[model samples]
Structures are given as C-alpha cells and as structure tokens.
Target: MTQLTPSPAGTEGARDAGDPLAEGRSRAGWWHARWVVPSALAVGYALSVLFRLSLVTDQDHPTVSPDEQMYLVMARFLAGRPTTEIPGDQIIPSGYSLLISPALRLTQEPVHAYHLIMGINALVSCLMLPLAYWALRRLNVSRPVSYAVGVAAATLPTVLFYTQYAMADTPLPVLVLLWLIGVHGLFSEGSGRRRVWFGLLAGLAAGYCLLTHDRGGVIIALTAVVLLAALAFNWAPRVASALALASLGVMFVVKKLMTAWLMARIDGARPSEVGNAVFDTLANTQLMRRTVMRCVGHLWYFMTSTWGLGALALVVCVYVVFSKRFGLADRVVAFLMVALLAGITLAAAAGLPADGRIDTITYARYLSPLAPVYILVAMAALYRVRGWKKIAALGTAASAVTLVLLAVLLRLAGAELVKSYFVVWGLPDATFLSSLWPANGDWGGFHAGRTTVIALLVLAVVLLLRLLAGNRRAALATGVAGLSLAVFAGVASAAITERITEPRTKGTQGIAAGFIEAAGIRPGDRMVMDDGLVWEIRATMTFMVLDGRVWSRALNKNAPVPAEADVAVFALADQQAPATDSWRNAPAGWHVDRDVREHQFVVWRRR
Candidate 1:
C-alpha cells in the first residue's frame, strides 16, 4: 500500500547473490566438523577390531589367569549353575562378578564369551575417542588439533593392546572419559538445565565405573574437585552450594542403586564380607607401599621407555608449568595431575606389597581411568604456545627421530630381556617366547626375529621421516607419521602373533575343552585338579568336584589326600613323592589317563 515499487529482475538477482567462496569454505568445513570426529574414530577402531579378530585363536582359548579364573567361577555360579564345589572366596568384588554374568551369557564357550566381553569393552573404549574429541572441541581447541588428539588416542599402543584383552581396565577408561566429558560440559556452562543433565550423566557414568572397578571412586573425586571449582567461580555462593548438594544427591542415589543390586547377588555371606575383604586388602601396609612404588616406576617407564609420545608429553608438562602462562584450564589440569599423583602416593603408602597384591597397586589397571586427563593436559600445555605452528613443526621433526630410535631400542631391549629371563629361569629357548616353535621348541629364532623387526622398524621410521620432510602442514605431517608408525606397529604385531602365538595349535582352552570332551565328561561329573588349570577344566566341563579339603589338606604341612576324591588331576607329573607312585601304580579298577599333549595332565578315575 505504501507504493512499494515492484522489484526489478536485476535487483532480485542482486539480493539473491550468495558468496560462493564462503559457501565453499563452509561446506569444506564439514570434513573437519565435530560430528566427523566420531566417524574417524569408528574407522580407526574398526581397523583395530579387525586386526584383533584376525589374530583370534580357538586353540589357545581363554587361558584363565589365577584372578580371571576366580571371577569366571563366580560368574558361572551366578548364571544359576553352580559348577565349582569349593567354598566361594569373598575376595572377588560382588559388583564386578554381577556385571560378568551378562557377559558370560553371550557365548557357551568361556573363552569366546570372554572375548565377546572384551570386544564390547574395546567398542566402549573406542567411543571414548569421540567423547574426548568433543570435550577438546568444547574447550576451544582447533579442529585439526582435536582430530589429531583423537587419532593419537585411538591408536595408542597401551589402549589398543588392552582393548583386545578381557579386563576391567578397558571399560573403566571409557566410563571415566564419559564422566570427564560431562564434567567439562557442566563446568563450561554452569547451573542450567544442561548442567543438571550433565551432572546426572556424570553421576551415572561414575556409578557404572565403580561397578566395573573399585578405583572409579578416584575418578569421581577428581571430577568433583573440578565441578566444585567451577561452581565456586561461576555461581552465587548459596546457589552453587545447592547445586553441589543436588549433584551429590544424584551421585548418592546412583551409588546406592548399584550397591544394592550388587549386594542382592550375595548368596552365602553378608555384603559386609565383601567389603571386609576389600578393606583388608587395602589395609595391607607393605602392599600399599609397593603399589605406590610400582605406579611411580610405571610412570617413569612410560616416560623413558620406547614411547616417544609419552616422553614428549612429560617434557611439555614441565615446560608449561615453568612458563608462567598458566590459565584456568592449566590449573584444572594441574589439579587432576595432583589428584592422580596423590592417589598413587596414598595407594603406595598404604603398604601394598611390591608384588602388586593390593587392590590399588596389584593391577596397575586402576590408573587407566586417569590416562585421558593426563593426555589432555599434555596436549593443552603444548597448545598454549602462541607461535605454535613453528613449534609444532620442530616438535614433529623431533618426534619422528625419537620414535625411530625408540622403536629400535624397544626391540633390542625386549630381546635382551627375554633372553635373560629365559636363560636365568632355565626355560626352553623357544624360537618364539611361549610359542611352540624353533623346531626344538626353543626361543632361538624369536631372539633373531626380534632384532630383525627392530631393524625394519627403524628403517620404516627413516622412510617415514623422509616422506614428512617436504610436508609443511603440521596436521598432515603428524597424520602421515602417526599412520606410518601405526602401520609398522601393526606389522610388528602380526609378526609377534605369527611367532609367539601361532605355532601352538592347541591353546589352553582348546586343550582343556578337548580333554573334557574326550573323557566323556558330563554336566554333573566332578573333576579335581591341584593346578591353576582347574578353571579351564571347570569352564569346559559342567562341574568342578575339587573339594576345598583337597587344597586345604595339601597346604596343611603336606597332609595326605582326601579319602572321598573319585578323581585326582595333578599338574606336576614330575614331582613323584607327593602321591606320584600311588597315582602311577594305580589298580586296574582305578585307571590313569595321562594327557601329555600340551603339558602333563593326569586324570585318575576310579573304575
């Protein structure tokens, strides 16, 4: 009505004109988008998974460690079929045992089931890569830097190696990472619906972490300190206090629910029995000290060992601390570092034995949850330099050189260490350590191959450095170097599999399973063994008939065998005095089935 002149075609065209270059830039940005981080992580993780699956051995099925076997038995019992007759030790955490039940259901074969559990763990761990990247991006790190960090994390040797194994350490890191992401979000945006949501998620993650492993409490403590600091800085005093209380309430509820569920699973004893065992383990003074020393030793080893990246992180941490450019993020990172150090120190001071028998120190797996924070701090410190491009270039060059040297040195050191240990222990010089190779089943070829692999790795590093020389892009150079190193590592890993694990056609699980199947063992048949192999047997067979009396009597000043035993499985066939003749010269009614295929396993059955 205001006599708006009809817009001319040219005017309309001018109005509709869009900046092509800007549009192009925006579209190209998707490649480095935050969402793409997870995709990249998934790719890397898929490769790792494929690599691990390729190396799977049905022959050497899941060899239960003394600790793993105990958990397996508990899981088996909890699955509603109590196979073992031995008095269930309350030493295993009820919470962890409860979690293992679901894992056991995925497969009928214990080893396959364990692998499936570990595979889930690995997937969970891989998901942490995206979480880590998101946190870094939220903290305002450049896209390239964030992606680089994710790649590094995804390919970390320690992470990759542990993910392939069935252990609590794998899931612990994932939960810790998720918790950290929630913590970071809460701190970055204080006191809102988002913050509340993050707080709840953090609580849930922390609670789940605790269910997986005991050291999750340490992760919660570290997270709380950060949230507290954020609240103090950003919110009104009373409001902040209220928010903190609310967070605690949420955490408490989650903890209570998890605890209740775990406690409900205890069949014979009160929940306090499990708690007491944990307390007793922690209260061991010698164990605590040794564990602390071991942590310190591992940290030292990580820094100085053949891992150049760790060494670089250590150097950067020292440099940033002294540079006087410390900011709030620096302080936050510093606090976490202090907390981890304190945790380790306190754990060590608790007198944990040097042998790692203490809960905190024994596994060293407890420290895994803190690993991401450590890496983040190191990366953040390096990023603080203003003219970082030049520094990054120099660092990349240095890293390349260091990596080559480290790889070579690691190979040489490993060979020497194996040679020394085997020679000193009077073990077979298997071509590959612990593998059935070298024709004579000795390690002579393994030592030689170890040296050759080291040399090849060094050469590969040299080639990689040369390829990187002309590359000016820091991100590109880092990617190339990382990928090259990862490839070389993969090759070396394959060689290890070929040499160490391949030759043993009948792995522990296969051997145990085969024996049980061949013996016509049924679901109700009881089997007793005086060795660690009993768990494998129990897993393969339907029942474990070994009475606690057998072990108890053996421990009681070498007491005689129990009168009720229908079958006896002795691990050590060489030791004769301990009922060896009685077993060897058994009557026709009591036949002896000697299995010397893998190791000497004797089964004495009453006819």
Candidate 2:
C-alpha cells in the first residue's frame, strides 16, 4: 500500500496547496480548467454513443456471451412480471437488471425492448470517457493527454465489443472507474463533510457494481478494507469511514432483500448456487497445485490479451505505485488495479467451469474491466518524462519486448510446471495459445511463428534505438508506434468478433419467440423444459419461455407433472423423455403441437 497524504480543502475546481501531485500550488487544479467542464464533455458522450449504436446489428438478442440470455430473463422479472422461470440461484445481481428492466416495461415487444437496452448500454458504457478524463485530470495528467486517452478508450475493442450484448460487463468498466475515483476522492479531501459525501458515493458505486455482477463482490470487499484501514490507520475522518461503511451495509441489505423478493416470485429458485460448490476448488488441499496453475494462467491471459500493451502499463504503474513523488490517490488507484486483477484472477480460478478446456486457462473476459487502464498507460507513455525519471519510460519499452520473450520462453519451456495440469485435466486446446502470438496473420496465411519473429526483431530495434541512438524523437516515435499497434490489435479483435457474432445472432435471433408463436403458447402458459438439453439450446428456449416454468423431462414419459404446465420443450423428436427418473420430472399427457427439427426440439401442449 502507498502512503497517504491528505489534500487540503479547495473549491470544486480550485487548486489545493497541500496536494503533492500538484505541478505547483498555483496550477494545482488544471483538470478543472474551463475547457474540461461538463458541457464540453457532452460532445464526447454523444459521439461515443453514436459510434456504439452504429455497431448494433439487426439482431436484438444475444449472439455471444451466453449470460446475456440469463440477464434478459432476470430483467424481465424485474420489470414487474409476477412470475418467472429463472431461479434465485441462477440469477445475477439485480443492479444491471434494474437498469435495463425498464426497457421491458416501456415496450411490449422484445425486439423494441432489446434495442432500448442496447441504447442504455451505449449510454452507460460511454460514461467511461468523461469519468476517465476526470480521473486523469485529477491525477495532474495534462488536459490534451487526458482527452486523447479518454477518446481512445471509448473506441477500443474492450469498450465497444461488449456494448452489443445485454450483459452487466457492458457498463462494468465505468462502474469500476467510478468506485476507484470515489475512494481516491474520500481519502484525499481535507473537509470532513466532503469526505463523508465521497465515502457514500463510493459505497453506492461499489454496491451497485455488486448488484450488476458477481465481480462486484470483490469491489465491496475492497471498499470495506480500504475504509476500515482509513479509520484504523487514522488516514480519514472517523465520520467519513463510518458513513461509508454504513452505505455499504445498506447496499448489502438491499441485495438480500431484492433476492428474497425475486425468489419468492420464482418456482424452486433455491440458494444452492451460492453454496460450497463454488469454493470446492479452493478448499481442497489436493487442488492447491491446480489452483496455483490457474492463477498464473489467468494473470498471463489478462496481460497478453492486450497483446503486450498491458506490460508497458504494468511498468509505468510500478514506478507510480511505489515512488514517493506520486500522490496517494495515483498510487492507490494503481494498487487497486493490481488488486482487482489479482482478485478477479483468483475468483475465476476458484470457480472454473471444471470443463478442463484449455481456453478456460486464458479466458480474457474476466479482466475486461481493466481495459481503460491500458489505454491510460499507452497515452501516458506518449508524454515525455517530466517529474519521473527516464528509466520508467525505457523500462516500459523493454517490458513489452520482455513479455514477447516470455511468451517465447513459455513455448520453449512448454510451461512444464502447468502443462501437466492441462494434460491431466483434459485435451489442451492449442488454440488457447493464440493469445500469446496474436496478430500472427493466421487469417492472412502468414505463419504465426514468423510473425512472432518479426515482432521480436522489431522490438529489439526499439530497444537499440533507445540505448544506442539515445534520441528523444526515437522515444516519442516508439510510444506512438506502440499505441498504434495496440489500437490496431484492439480494432482487429473487435472486427473479428463482430463479424463472427453478428451473422449467427441474426440467423437465430428469433428461436425462442418463434417457437412460442408457432405453438400459440400464451403469456400465461406454464412451460417445462428438458433439463437434459445442452445449455445453448436450453438457455435460448428458456429466454423465450412464458413465466412460471419447470425443468423436468419425466413429464414426457407419463410421470407426475407439475400441477399446471401448458407447454413442454424437449429434444426428443419421436421418442418420449428418457426413463432416467420419474420423480425428477413432470407427468406426461402432451400433444406435439410443433416440431422444429432443425433446432432438435419439439413443443408439446398439454392435452
């Protein structure tokens, strides 16, 4: 943890004399400059929304990120629906659903509601630009630099790629940034009243983040620790700490209440999902080896997912974090970044899908909330070393090459320490290694190995230019090249993902609703699904199902059924449900009303 130095009181945009981050006492509040006002930021917000909206395809439903179906189902419940098929155990936090559920209430058609939710996502996601700009400004980063970074982040694939999906991740980065800034604000301010306000706001952001996704749990925990430290260490006023803790407690109570309410309205939506199973991997002593391997793999995936840009950011952050010259807020934010990466990595490791697929090793979405930080590093690198030493810049360049070499080393070393873990688990998918050698031109028929060689040799050129030539232009050019490469990589990834996702989504957009309409299943109909069906088909069908549903295939075999069920969706085309267990499913007496053989399911209406 970085040492804390309390900042003196100043106006909203006024200069604070006690702030060590200040360039000078007179110019302390440069981030509060006339041009950086809220009205000026409106343009960036509008443009960001437009760009994201342009990315929206005709498909109103989820194309990727399977959790979208679950989210929308939960949203429907929150939109004042009386009954729901989704269980409490399977539901996500209510925060994001609260944001999008209104869309469902405002319109009757699912398509219209989806577009509205997409618009909300765009608007919410774009909040990053202004928030990022403000945060950098407060850190004493120059105005032009802050604005550039903000714009760059808005367009980056990490921000744009998820906007098309109706998931909490869409607004997550913004929420994370807000929580971070609030922490910095509360701790730095001199006024007790302002500190209280900042603390409450921080709690609000932290709590809502939890409501939006399970990852928010990490944020809340961090918030509690930070606040308690503030009080115990006498870093912040007692009142401020107390209030923040209070807000967090209140938010937690709200989460419980919301869950209880939703659960009561649902059928058999038990609390099993929140139990010991989630921590099974972490609890077992025998799995320690696998857990350690998972942690390492997750960390590497998070950094390399940005294709080495994060390595440079990590370098800059190391200096700003430990060095005494930087302000407490800057150092703390950096510390939280590292902490968040660690927290998410560990959590993902503990709750891994247990599928043993290699892609699970390098899954990047777990750390997507940190995307803005990489752009910040990229932009910060472009500036000359002012208060800091030149070693930071040089080390940043070297770090990128270092990462490339490490990737090579992993390939050479076969990552032997963890390689066996994969072999023992299941088939090691070589494709997961694609994260390490990104942009190797596989699609263009250029060999990945050759591309790796080219990248290594070019970075070598960059290092030599710094060490031998020793010119400042070389430094600036290097930063520009790195930033450009990062942008190019991000855009390429976004394009590839969109291209792959859009067509599939468009083709199958109407699966659930089509089946409902085809079979004339009414809104009040009770539905049952074959629990044996794979998640892809089941989630799709479940998303379109009417409220009040059951999961039982035994009903197809004349087993006792739920007291009421109007329709049953099963994969069996000609045969009845498999005689697995009668009590586990509902009773039979269904007439096949529709057979969508292409999807491998048929809708049977109760006779």
Candidate 3:
C-alpha cells in the first residue's frame, strides 16, 4: 500500500494547480511538502558529509576519542581474528564494531581500514537526517518544521563530529530513531498484516539498538511502558498491542543474552567476582549527585548550543496540553519526547560517574545519541506555531542585537559560566565546558561560553514573550531563529573544536607511529608495551600499525626482557632515559629508541 501523507496546512489534500511551485509529479509531488523537503535535507547532509571527508584526509589516521579507539580495536578483532582466538567476556559491546568489521576485511592497511570504518559511520549519521525527517512527517509535523528538523540533525555539531569518529554515538541515535519510526508505523497502519510487520520491525530495531549500546536498555524499558500505556488507553486492539509489546520485550531479552554470550566468547571468560565488586563499589551513592549534576550540565549545554531547543520543547509541551489543539498523534509525539529525554537524562546520571572530577569531555559524548530526538521535537514544536514569517524576521533581528550586547558585556566582565557552575556545585572546577567551550579558544576562551548562555537567554525570553502574548507568528519566528542560531553555533563550535584538537590528536598518532617505525617492528612481530603506558596509547598503537602484535606486560624495569620480543615500549614517569638494567646482558645488537612523549622503545635483533 502507498504511504498516505496528510496534506500541509492549506493544501487540503491537493496543491493549487495554478501555483508554479506545485508543478512536479502528481498531486503528492515530493516537492509538494513531502518528498522535496527530505530530498533537500539529503542534499545538505551530503554536503556536510563531503566537508567532513575533506577534513579526514588531513591526518594519516582518523581522529579518535578513547572510546572510539576501543571500538576500532574491536572492529579489528572482528575483521581478522579466528573464532577460536576470540575472548569469552567483553566489557564493551561489539555490535558497533561488528557492524564496521566488513570495512576492515576489505583493507589490510590500518589507515585505510580506519577510513572505511569512519566512512560507514558518516554515512549512517547522514542517513539519520532523512530518517528524522521521515519520522517527523509521519508524526504529521508541518513541512517547514520537518525540514528544519532534518537540517538540525544533519548539521548539528555533535551529530557531525561523532559521525566522523569511529564510535556508536552516531549509530545509536539512528537506531533509536528507526525504532521510533517503526513504532509510529505500527500504530498508524490499519491493515493487520502491516501492523504486525511494523511491530516486528520496531522490535528488531529496538533490540539492535540495545545490542549496540547499553543505553538502549533505557529505550527498551521505555518501549514496554509506552506499550502498557497504549493498552491501558485502548489505543489499539488487544491482539495487536499484545503482539508488539511481547515482540519488543522478547527481542530485548534475546539481544541481551546473545550479547552476553558473544562478549564472554570474545573476552575469553566472564567477568569475575572481583570485577563485579569493583563495579558495585564504584556505583556507590556518593557519586550520584556529581553524575546527575554533570548530566544536567550536559543537557543544559546541549540546549544552549541548539538555541535553547530544550526550553522551546518545554513551552510547546505545556501549550499543547492546555490549548487542546494537539491531535492524538501530536500528543503521542510530545509524550514520547518527554519520556525519551527523561529516560536518557536519568540513564546518563545513573550509568556514569564523574570519576572524582568533572570530565567535561566524555559525559557530553553520551548525549549525542539523543541529538536527533532533540532536533525533531524542537522542530516539531516550531511547526505547530502558525504565521512564522514576520515573527521569524523580527526575532532574528532582535537576536542579532542581543548577541552583540551580550558579547560586549561578557568580554568586559570576563566571567566564565563553567567556573561559576562548578563553584556552585562545589566540584573541582574543570574550567572547560565539555561541549560548550569553543575548541580553538578562537572566540576568546570562556567568552564563547558566555555568549552561548546569553544567546539561549535571548531565545528563551523571546519565545516566552511570544507564547505568553498569544502571538503565534512571533513565537514561530522565535523558534525558527532559535533553530537557526542553534545550527550556526553548533557548526561553528565543531569547526573550532576540530581545529584545536586536530593537532593534538595528530601529535599522539605521530608519536605512536614514530615508535613503531623506529622499533623496526614488522608484521606479526611481538611488541610489548609497559603497563603504565595507559590504554589510550596502547589502543592508538594497535590502530596505527595493525600488523604488529601489541601487549602490555607489567614487568619491572629491572626484569629480563622477553627474548621472543621484537620491540618493547615503556612509558616513563618523565623524560627519563631507558635504564640498561632491564637489558644489560641483552643478546647481540640490541638498542633503545625515544619518542617525544618520553616513551622509551627498545628493539631487539637476533644474531
């Protein structure tokens, strides 16, 4: 059956034939608010992907966060290792790695393999834009707002940044969005067969999401709750509702069990009692407040960057509830939006700890998985507001003035919101706002943070005034401007971030590469790293040159070097030279090497 799309507000199921803009396809031409909008969005997304691809070529290896490095290693394992060599227990899920392993199999070169994995990630992330657009359209959002939603998903800095990195941050959002799309289909389709198929698809998508990241556990739980609510309200027939609920619940459980089995197999053993004890200890309540605070900070940070989309969503929800203009579909979207935000917030708060200090960088990464939802709901709210043209122009003008004034005032005061927030919370001030701080400090470090706060404040005030005054046009304008500023801020911030961090990441890669080259290590050569080198370096080494066998052995500096080793790298406390005691009586033709990071590499040759 052909998908039925509701006509836009004025079209009444058909376009004005005399209007030249309506001169495409049949009565439901994609250019007629359904297809054209998503197509345009796809074009924009493609451009962004191209831009990201251009940046990727600048470095020998793609930039990787620590988590990304882990995924890359897992991908490598999946790509090459024999089934028997796979371990029995995995701390990290392999779904994402497994998804990208095909790229690795196609290429033997580490850099090429890394590019392939990131290319796949970028493609998936780009596809999310259209997925979001389709989902919004299915939920009956207006054409303009759906386009905005798609654009936001495509261009948002966090979305774009992670897409270029080899991590599940990009994939999870797409998966969750797919699940939501399936859920929407399950409810909206009338045919029993179609409903059943949609239900199955929804269940599969949710399960796949769960397998990709533990965060999907929250999505799974939310699915059951939503299904229960639907059943309670008689939203669907008993048989259909029961089937979907059961299918989703069963899929979630099956995925969990399957993942556990796969992880155990890959890790070589299940987690031991000691590991569980440490996990329990680390999960103590004393850390909850900090984690919650950090997550809250991240949410606020995301909202600010997105032109206060979260704030706009709140106002829209309240208005929808009171105005009684919302149809069932709209109401459902609103409810699902709230549930997802709450679920992710609580999950972030509970699932991670601040680790004794504010790690401004890492916690924000968790929020990227929800970026598409945030963009969708925010845009959906805007679409609900009518007569936005004049108000949008006015709001944009007002926003420009507000931004200038705020920047001037902030520059004079020299205040940094990040420091203030930390001081209030009594946490060690980390100085940098993980996702908010302009990466290059190009915008005057902390000045950018201040400007962001002011921008959010302006957008919020304008939106509230428009809403309270019952000026729907102005409210619409404010929403549009807010979204516009959101894209601008996010894109600019990401570019600065890349510029600032690229060199450092490249430097790290260079150091690892230098060590590998100097060691004269060849394919299959055993290269042991000192235990103190940290996983970051170890992982980088593993990715930089995939051929060499790498391991970290907790050997003392004085211990005899393994005669089987071709090379050994040691992480020193400082710029200390390698002590000869470890290899004093080494076999003939042994020598040591150094890298800029104060690491010592020794290469051993046989006579």
Backbone steric clashes in candidate 2, count: 4
Model 1 TM: 0.65
Poorest 10 consecutive residues of model 3 by lDDT?
423-432
> Which candidate number maximizes TM-score?
2
Error of 3 at 220 (Å): 0.9
lDDT of 1 by residue, 1-607 (tens): 0010112212321211122222346544555455664577677668656666666543234343434444444555556543343234333443444555666665555446665655555456666566666655554444445556665555443444444444465566666667655544444334466566666666567656655555655656666665676666763233433464466557656656644543455333233243344457577775554434445433433332223334344445444444454443333444455555456435433433323222221123344455555554445333333344544553564355444544553443443334332221111111222233224444432233332233334434533453444323333443344445455445544554454344442455344456655544444344544443344454333222211212222311244444554565655435434434434434346566554434545566666
Task: Give the better candidate number (2 or 3) by lDDT.
Answer: 2
The RMSD of every model to the true structure, in order and in angstroms, is 10.6, 6.2, 7.2
lDDT of 1 at 563: 50
Q: Give the per-residue lDDT of model 2 (tens digit) for 1-607.
A: 1122323445435442222323343553655566555766788789778877877746576544347766776787888754645532365577888888888788756667788999999899988888877766555444444565577666666556667778788878888888877888887856788778888888888988877778888888888888888788877788888898899999988988887877776655654253355488778888776566666665555454444455556666666678887676667666777777778878877777656455455445667788676556534543433222353454456455445544653553344434323321111111222333545423222122343333344434434433442333433333344345445544554554454446556666545455556556676667776665445545654455534444544444565556666767666543455322212343456566776655556666778
Q: Each model's C-alpha lDDT?
A: 0.46, 0.61, 0.56
**Poorly placed runs, candidate 3 (over 4 Å):** 1-30, 33-42, 59-65, 82-90, 142-145, 231-233, 246-254, 261-288, 318-328, 356-362, 387-452, 457-490, 557-566, 572-579, 582-599, 605-607
lDDT tens readout by residue for model 3, 8-50: 3334345432223333346566556556664687687787577
TM-score of each: 0.65, 0.79, 0.75
Better of 2 and 3 by TM-score: 2
Model 1 residue 166 lDDT score: 44
Q: Comparing 1 and 2 by lDDT, which wins?
A: 2
